[model samples]
Target: MKKKITVALLTAAISLSLVACSNKENVSKNEKLEDTVVVYTTHKEEMLEAISDEFTKETGINVEFINLKGELADRVRSEKDNPQADVMFGGDTSTYMQLKEEGLYEKTEPQWKDELDKSFKDSEGYWYGTIKTPVMMFYNKDLLSADKAPKDWSDLTKEEYKDLIVTRDSLSSSMRSTVCALIENNIKTKNEDAAWKYLTDLDKNIKNYYNSGSVMYSAIGKGEAAISIAVLSDIIDNKENNKMPLEIVDAESGSVVITDCVAALKNAPHPNAAAKFVDFVGSAKVQAMIANDFNRIPTLDSALKDSPAWMATDYKAMDVDWDVIGKNQSKWIEKWETDIIDNNKVEKQ
Candidate 1:
């Protein structure tokens, strides 16, 4: 009884390089690429620069941004001597936790540390989630229809949906995290093999596999694939302003939730600016950028609204142990590669 595997709709698998430009739009001592503040992020370029520009407007801090790609953790670690980023923003909380273990964070500033969540945030004041993104089921409304869409976790194998669901390779860090949680819960009969079997069945149903997080939203939006698991942030942000019938669902069976946060490097070149960036993200205005403007949930209380539909719903999520994610990632990735992807065990519905 292998458990089901669904990739959360993360806003971006993007490496947001924040090149700080002054509002003056000229290279000056305080704002030039070499002289200005250096910030690093993996957020989408549009959102990253939009928010960074706002910060520049208010503070007059000269900024230079570099767009990063590939695994941020690897990049940051590899550049230990000449680390490029002062603040890492917009990655899953688990990555932050893993970095904290590696001693990457400075751990000075605190953002409602104990109050928001004891488990999620760092106790030493290293990192905190500025916005949250919960994992939920996303299906093409036209294909699934309200009645045909999944309302529960087990719906992955219904007679009608046998070959309708689509998902990522289980080896992906995003999907692997959620899968570990699923296995831990014994959701697939407390037997990991059973869980793998279920994943295989769902894998067979997938029409295609994607390498980028944005592809999920794009796929579902265009009806290229009928169903997928995604983070709420990606789905909502990519949601058409012109109008499209894309739909995201929260299952009574449970949805996995995660948050994207900001963390300062332990010896950041611009400590003052780094802390300010965290506070800025924590503010309602910035939170709104994540929620109303971007479709991710605000971490602060003021940004929340009455609506909790889809990714917004106040559901029971795993306590979100970043440490667990860091340790188990290699094991899960290896298993998924050998058992599924490498052998071409994956299928398309």
Candidate 2:
């Protein structure tokens, strides 16, 4: 599906104008403005630009973003003495859990509190979930027809797909969290041995592990890898924008649904502007815009009703405790690196 440019045209225009008019010798008046919001986000550029532009248009406050794919929390903690960003956006709930534990965010009342589900937001409003990004697998459409594609996570262990699957390195926090969920939902729920056995078996088919999700998806799109695991949004964006021949498979066993959350720094340089930006992004209007144009599952109930037909509606969220996952993250990673990973490498060799 093509992006609906009509929703964010002025944002693109303003972004281009800012770039084209760059002059170190002569700083523009807008650059000199004091009330700008500095955003640290993991959102894709398109999503960031659109939301920022609309915030600028409505509040007359400029938005500057620093893209941090998976390290926003650590970066914010490092900059605690001198907060560089007013807000952090688009990391998953686990990211927010860490931030909340470390007291990195300020509790603020969001405009969409009533519209959002209680489970999706922090009880005290430290962070809020904006959209649902499900964990799923995709295959190269050119190489595998729909009927031939793997039906679920367990199917990935089949011998036919041996050395044909790719995924982000388990070292990455996002990938690690995904691994934890897979173990929790697919294996540990029934028995630990079953989960370990499944992961070890699946590892046999992993031909490569990518450092970045983008590179992994690119490999699958180019048919360099026939199958890969990724987020639903990434697959949609790649197929629509890059014309990548990819098709998504909702894990028939059940899929873990995670959300991209937004929060404001506890000691933000621009506190009021940060609050405004957060509220604007969480508002029904912007959430609806995201749902319609980008095919993301919105957190707002009203936005869900307004979402585009292409956006999925009937997928079951895996029953897992995010708090338990967040607390045991380090231990899980250690086990993965020592046991699961070590065993997989030896077997493949």
Candidate 3:
């Protein structure tokens, strides 16, 4: 959320503090333990700060956040021999999948995990899911012919749509995961050849390539581009609050959706505090706050019933077989270079 505080610097102070239950700092082992709950997250810093502040008020547990973006998994992997974070929060499911491989995540049994949708949570318990950020087709109503607006994935490849697609960079980014998911799940493809061909054609329609999801939305809203494969919550949050003309369509075929998940870290300095935060946030109370106030779609079914803004559509299907994308990550990236992008491709500002 906020810039990550230094764990190495604070480690000594916290070590000295935990040595004995001295009320010198005004909290003790028996009295809310002064253990710093280190959180590594990619959610917008504003949202993370709010959640951390609320959690502190409710439990009196102090939090030291390690906020990061884009290359978080690389940073965490480098720091794994001496892990700094107690809990990993936010970001797409694939990032967590990579972390799960590094033994960075601990097997935790949060009580709420059982209450979640089975597809959302990991079976071996290295990670758990929350919130529903579904893939959406965000369209600018003013820019293109009404016939150009997309209702489903297939609309992107129409004859008149030859030179009007916008996309993101695939090199070392989560955009590749979405592409990989789109091919592996939504396409009725036992035909990998067809999937490859579609990607090639989609590549040719590029009006521009964007580096940020926020920019993609802004570009679409300003009529700089016609549509985007953006998150539903991101689009609706902008529209409902800022009154942008952009709107999201829940395709007839389900889109690539994922949850913003959190997990206990392996070798955490404060396991008890970490587990408690996990259990706390997974509750209906926190999930509902995420839905109602923060624009996060709830994974808890009870919260879904009340928060229409988050789960307003009947489009419920999410792509399956995430392991295919995770396992074949590099090959898919290579496929992009081979079949889709080149130096001559549209450049992002």
**Model 3 over residues 191-303: C-alpha lDDT tens digits?**
77777777777776667777667676676777777777766777778888878877566676677776678898888878767886787777787888878777888888877
lDDT of 2 by residue, 1-349 (tens): 0122221242352233232122224233453433467788777688778887676666666677777665666678888877867888887787688778988998878767877888899988899998888877889989899998998888999999988888887545557768888777654567777877888888888877777677777678677779987777777778888888888787777777787889989988778778877888988899889887777778887887788765654665577778767766656666776777634332121
**Per-prediction TM-score:** 0.75, 0.79, 0.82
Candidate that beats the other on TM-score, 2 or 3, i.e. the better one? 3
Alpha carbon lDDT at 298, candidate 1: 70
Q: What is residue 233's positional error in candidate 1, in angstroms? A: 3.8
Q: Per the 3 Å backbone cut-off, how many clashing residue pairs does candidate 2 have?
A: 0
The residue ranges of model 1 lying beyond 4 angstroms of the native Cα positions read 1-35, 110-115, 157-162, 168-176, 186-189, 212-215, 221-223, 237-242, 305-321, 342-349
Residue lDDT tens for model 1, 1-349: 1011111211121123334444445223462232234556556666766776776775655544554533556767766665555677766676777788888888755545544565547777888877776777877777778887888656775667755665665434456656655554443345767766666665566666665665555666676768887776666655555354668776765677767777877666677677666666666666766566556677666557522344355665654445666666556556756765433534333
Ordered list by lDDT, greatest first? 2, 3, 1
Scored against the true structure, residue 229 in model 2 reaches a CA lDDT of 78
TM-score of candidate 1 against the unseen true structure: 0.75
Candidate 3 TM-score, C-alpha based: 0.82
